[model samples]
Target: MFSNAVKCRQIHLIATSIAHYWPLLHERPLSTLTTTAISQEPSMFVTSSIFIILYCGLSLMLCWCDYQSGLLPDRFTCPLLWVGLLYHLYLSESTLSSAVWGAIAGYVSFATIYWLYRGLRGYEGIGYGDVKFLAALGAWHGWSVLPQLVLIATILACVTLGIKIIAGRKRQVLYNPLPFGPFLAAAGLWCGWQTLISPPP
Candidate 1:
């Protein structure tokens, strides 16, 4: 079980790497980073589509890897994210650097939770892997996905916690070190879809 920071970090790295690889495998238009090969102009829908593809694919892979190996092998997510940064820079043709900020925001937010878990003695409450995984996820869509991600994570964590409490009927159940990466990844996917459908500011 992923009962430690190292395990959490490993999961994060794996999930991030999966997210980074998605665009490469998808054959996205190098120039537009959109859904179709059209004029150079960008459309939010196209961006959202690409993001969804990456998010979903990455989510499944990360979860599966966690289940089977119990190790999210760093050889994957970390370096792959750097590659994703370069890839996004080349494709989107924008100086805003969406990927870089997204990754940074994800790491900061997730890391904050990780530290909080440590401070509060809430191990098994969250993992370091959850943190890095968010880095890659945030790198995908940035802060826009964060609110929804938190909402989803909170909802799922509560539901699971309740179920866990019920399953054993123990007053002081030691929470198992389970994977939160997949849930957060799902939240990110749903959040990306929301961005696609919502009216722009």
Candidate 2:
């Protein structure tokens, strides 16, 4: 009876050892699993840094072009619109339909104001290029951001124009056409930067 009991205890010990090491024999090492998991996710810091550099650089270039030439070329705005749409397509942060509607709303809103101002005042108040630029920005930021964009741009434009008049010391009212693209680009950049820096809830 004692001999049988000893044999049973020995068998139990062996079975316990096998169970503990079963994964070692059948599965990959823990280090490999860790490496694979790390590789799957992107670092938000790196992605945000790259986005800021590229987007802000592009904004500055557009600002310079508009300030100097009073034009936001199709070369810039068209690519901007396509890239925004593609970003939404791949990232899935926003729906493609939202972007399309945003673009249409941006263009139509500005065009309506432009035509109404022309009819009432007998001159163009804003350029067609500004309309396209706003549409591109809308595509990038979606329709929800358009109202804020316009409000910020308008406020800044008014403030800047006031400062310029004060600086020039012109007592009489001077109705000079100012390039609106820079204000729009600046407001767009501010919105983008805010979005990037804020943490997701």
Write the residue-wise lDDT of candidate 1 on 45-118 in tens digits.
56645644554666667766765654454544564355446445544536226667878888898788778877
Question: Evaluated with lDDT, which candidate comes out highest?
Answer: 2
Off by over 4 Å in 2: 1-18, 22-34, 43-51, 93-97, 169-175, 197-201
Candidate 1 runs further than 4 Å off: 1-55, 68-71, 79-87, 94-96, 119-125, 169-175, 195-201
RMSD of candidate 1 to the truth, in angstroms, is 25.3
Q: RMSD of model 2, in Å?
A: 4.1
Clashing residue pairs in candidate 1 are 8-129, 9-129, 17-77, 102-138, 102-139, 103-139
lDDT of each: 0.63, 0.78
Each prediction's Cα RMSD?
25.3, 4.1
In angstroms, how far off is 138's CA in candidate 2?
A: 1.1
Model 2 per-residue lDDT tens digits across residues 59-101: 6777899999888888888877777666566555546677778
